[model samples]
Target: MRLLAFALLSLWACGCAPALSTFQPAHVADKGHVQAELGLDVSVPTGAIASVVDAGVVLANIAESRELTEGERLTLFEAGGALALNPPSVTPHIGVGYTALDRWELNLRYTGSALRLGTRYQLLKRAKHGVDLTAGAGVGRYVIDLPVGSILGLVELEDFTRWQIDLPIQIGTAGTWYRVWGGPRLMFTTFDTALVVDLPAFTGYPGERELASFSGTGLYVGGQAGVALGYKHVFLGFELTLAEIFSSGELAVLGERAVAVDLDSFIIYPSIGLMLEF
Candidate 1:
């Protein structure tokens, strides 16, 4: 039962973890110009307390059938990398971008746990000391997994997936040596999660069984800001983003009432990267 609680908490953490997106500049690259970047990201949760409370409730309900003592319930909640308020995690990312015809750009990025593809079209060129405009769209997919040991009797948490899409309008300026950009992004995401538990015949529950599963989708509006400095073919950049999510979803155990888990409404991301342009 303790192992089961730990597995549940791990799944919840993975589902709520943040994935960073690449910053898009308003100006497209020159034809045949290619850019590659490597970066690290940190997500600061502004509403982490709410997320923790939600997870705690879900875990408590799961243990209700086992008649856990209050102390055991507390311990269960704290085990297996339990959700923490304001605890931040770091992830590394890599991306490659290309420009075609000096007017169109495409970028593909991976952030360890997520994959993103984006495209942009230059709508208007920048005048001297003025801003340029670009419109673009992005799609991303993410997967999260948590595997408990076979010694624990075949408890596996896998196949937690999320898909996201966004449309952004960028307004910014680019000069020979520097660039600054900001944009408003409209986005949506959907999730599918599963938890599988298999105990040995000696443990009473002998067969494999799914403990919990859920699906949900959310819509969000966000803003991003970025700045970069270029010297020759090498550039360095930093990006910051904040978003609010309006989400609706319910988690369903095989034989229990569906539990509603409202996702965190506020999210923040900060990242820095080194880029090479050729």
Candidate 2:
């Protein structure tokens, strides 16, 4: 009985004893494996920043922020030429942008900014191949130029507000290190016009005669796709998207007579970007 107890104690000590973190052992499984990841994405100029941050916050919130926060994050996690994604994770993004005048009376020619927050949740927590999905939201703003032929003040220009929502469907490959993701975006926009010369605070037009005022709004839809290249300590990837915006608004100019102006336009823009995981 004493010999058996000694044998059991030795086995326990050997099995439970921890190894030095930097130490790597030779194994059929390769002594390298990643447990978590963080990614930064930039491509779409206007809303990229907000989108990335949103994704990252989500991943952090759900999975307890495994991303190295040491003020510097990792970009990829790889092993045997594949990625490492245990179950739950977070991804963040940021970007900048510029708009320009086009075929419409209401054209834009200015810079804008963006960001995002996102996260992934695993449905089957213990399986090597599981179903994980992600979601994020963000906001952006830009300045637009009007065809009224004046550029002196803010009144001659309009304000364009944009909102973003992202949803990603991710699936782990069968007994592999790669995961696939795809989703569509629902975007919203509002164009606000200002009164030139601060017309009486609430007066609708530039003059007391109340000739006309212009305004507009647009809605856009688009899709994006990407793959997560996971390494044991980092991740690397990229994505591309194409979006089309449709808008219409009313405009009026008056001195003594009343005339009506209608403005309509369609805008198409495409973007591409890269991401690093830490």
Candidate 3:
């Protein structure tokens, strides 16, 4: 995915000069000017931890010894340990955003899906360089899982999703070429799960939907860098971001268990977008 993102961005960013320059058709470029920011932010994290999963797919594709065709039968167990290391999961995402900068220069941003909504206010803003602070919170569902074995019973894993809250604080520089930011966010959960052996049966466990569960929360810090170009009413930009998602939860299953499973992750995503400002 990182390879694909890099490739795609290179094409767009390289071809964007004229497009960026033409995006401010009505802007008179003066005091009390009002503008709106409408863009899509997509993040994809590909650090060492993520590579572990990606390499598994590459090796498996090679070992399969056959040309992999779309719609063809492909089984993880058949592919070997490589497939085992990777989980059947879709990346978490948020989209649909709108922002407005009033004549007084106050900025407001709203970004998220229907399941959750995140709103941020720029406590400070400056076109050249200045601090822009944001605070946001929302509710969502997640879970903690333990290893499965002959005993936690049928190891028939299930019941591991819970309601939760996400509170993130962000501080960045407001700029046209780029903006750099770093801050910590707090995560809190309504329930908790803990210690035991992670047996071979659950070595590649992503999560057992059937196992009733809860995950403890932790604090996280991350940063984002963004660049934009505009010509007339058309504008283009991209952002690279990374966040340390921390959550440590332990669990005992069947007759086995595991402790302090790294429920934390680092992710990156690059996105392209178009916006019209008034």
* TM-score for each predicted model, relative to the true structure: 0.72, 0.37, 0.44
lDDT of 2 by residue, 1-278 (tens): 43453343223222111000000000011122212222232222123222322333333232232323311111110000000000011113232111111110111111112223322233332243353333333343432222232211112223323333333333223124343454564555444343232122233333221222334454555555555454443334444444443434333333221222222222222222232222
Best by TM-score: 1
Q: Assess each prediction's global lDDT (C-alpha) against the native.
A: 0.61, 0.27, 0.35
lDDT of 1 by residue, 22-55 (tens): 5656677778897688887665554643445445
By TM-score rank, best first, the candidates go 1, 3, 2
Instruction: Please tell me which model should have the higher TM-score, number 2 or number 3.
Output: 3
lDDT score, candidate 3, position 112: 27
Residue-wise C-alpha lDDT for candidate 3, range 1-278, written one tens digit per residue: 76773444333222111011111111121344444455544433344334443443453344334433321211211111111111221222323333434322223333321133344444544543445655555554432231231111111223333344655555554334343444553544433432221222233443222222224444335554455565644456554545554545443333244233343456444444554334
Which window of 10 residues has the lowest lDDT sum in candidate 2? 78-87
- Give the least accurate 10-residue stretch of model 3, judged by summed lDDT: 16-25
RMSD of 3: 12.0
The TM-score obtained by model 2 is: 0.37
> lDDT score of model 2?
0.27
